[model samples]
Target: MFKGDLTVAAAYLTPAGGAVVTSVSPVGLADRAANEVSFTTSLGFPKKLERILHNPRVSLAYHTREHGFATHSHYVLAQGRAAVDLQPSAQRLAELMDASELFLGRTKRGGVWDWLLREYHQNRVFVDVHPDRIAVWPDLSASGPATVTGAPWPRHPAEQEPPKNGTTPRVPVAKLARQIAALPHRLLAYQGADGHPVILPVTVTGHDETGLRLAASSELLPPGGRRAGFLAHGFQPQCVGVSMRTVTGWLTVEDGRALYAPHTSTGMTAPPNRLVTTVANGLLAKQGLRRAQRNGTTARLHDLAARHRAQGSERQPTAFEDAPAQSTRPQR
Candidate 1:
């Protein structure tokens, strides 16, 4: 039940191999025939796109139902490999207009609308995801077991080895804990056996030298440990003035609880006004584009566009084994 206006939390990994969770706006089932889902971002925000390019495994979690899919108590965690379409030709964008309207409301004409959304629309890059494992919980509370569907769940009896020396909290536990507590939305991201990321909502119950103590369903947290990511944020519509805290570290899940040892911490808080936001986006996009130019990423994106133009299709969806159509969807 992804709708354009519904915001969902998404996760991806950094090149160094740490999970980072963030929010994506207006995601939806972009291709009904293919059963494909996608989210969009601009070239201005190239970092996440770059990360996706490096590693395709990602996840989208739907914990809310307002203005979204069928009203149900189910919470869905969709994990899959993702493909990014760097900004393409104007014709491609034209083809996307109908779907855009379906999720994002109709477009307007004239200069005012143009001025407000110029940066937003100019270099729209779409990230299309083909889910491999979809875990549906009985309720948003994650109180019961999940009804797993799609491709088989890959198991990692012995998760990939941790770093040689092991990881510890880079940011002071007190500071990180304090920051995390201030934000209402807290999510944890960890690498699965298949390298796809698993993300689940968690509560920051407490913290110590080991890491930030987390409270989550044991079923969602693998008992053995692995390096993981933690994100805590708060936002209004469009996430204009969002304030978020992120940390990458070690994750230990056992005894129905979890612990995170943060190896690094970073965060940002932006202004809320659309005018101010657009201005800021323009400036940042300019700088990011310049960096892309210097790194030859600009040409790389153009090459991808050319390839896409030649092929002109998305990643084909796979069947969900024996599950019936209705069962494949999140159930109440």
Candidate 2:
């Protein structure tokens, strides 16, 4: 290969179990002598070459592209090779000015040229491949008119199985959404001052339709400001023959830390108030469905349903006149 060409680079099986094609020369290429027709690398090769050249049977393929057709110009197959010459001690200290210049030219913007040169000096090696046979294959598809073969190039050890979908494991979607909605309360529930609910941040461990399961607490903040207190809220819905309608959890505060109580249980509950019944009745009325007359009790349920539905749609919740007062803990 000549200078100023990127495609003519050499590929080698590295000792550390990988295939590498580097423009960086591990061995000096031009020390062939005054009139010698052959050349070798500066050092022998990486120790990996020991395993690779053990049998001394190898094939090297080269591709030349011209006018949309690739022409194979120089393909050399070699065998029965041995490390014949060690790099001369005198030449070991000797540096190749051309390789140094090539190294400098190879760098891009912002490269530390001197540092790379030093590294190259420490790692470069030279190898001499003894030729047993040589072949030049012009076309790979034709499988015709080719010379030199022992076996295909040894498989590189670095080839790994393509990962399934390029990832080790993946998560499902629907369950993830439910976990997100329930995360805040489940993570932060701890006992607040005077039994008030302190809300904490939550990191979910798992999730499903029922609730988000927790692996860790959400009480990560330091005490101060509006966050000093906690509030608890619960919601439960009831419907005939729908035994699964229930959702409840607690929020709490303790020791300047807030956390959510775990969601340990659930079940359908009767409507919370007369308004709830009124709202349910309104829903039925809007559908033009009236319950059979039963001591006018169904009418009362309808009225209650209407009331609850109206309250539910309020822009801001109305404080219950008999709502439980939040307890305040004494400051330490």
Model 2 quality (TM-score)? 0.28
Query: Model 2 — which ten-residue stretch has the worst lDDT?
Result: 314-323
Candidate 1 residue-wise lDDT, 213-265, digit = tens: 88887766787777788888776643556678877788876776777888888
Q: Using TM-score as the measure, which candidate wins?
A: 1
**RMSD for each of the candidates:** 4.5, 39.2
Candidate 2 CA-lDDT value: 0.28
Candidate 2 stretches with Cα past 4 Å from truth are: 1-47, 53-55, 64-116, 140-142, 147-332
lDDT of 2 by residue, 108-205 (tens): 22344334333233323334333332333333221334343332222111222322333111333243334334312221222222111222223445
lDDT of 1 at 164: 70
> Each candidate's lDDT (Cα)?
0.68, 0.28
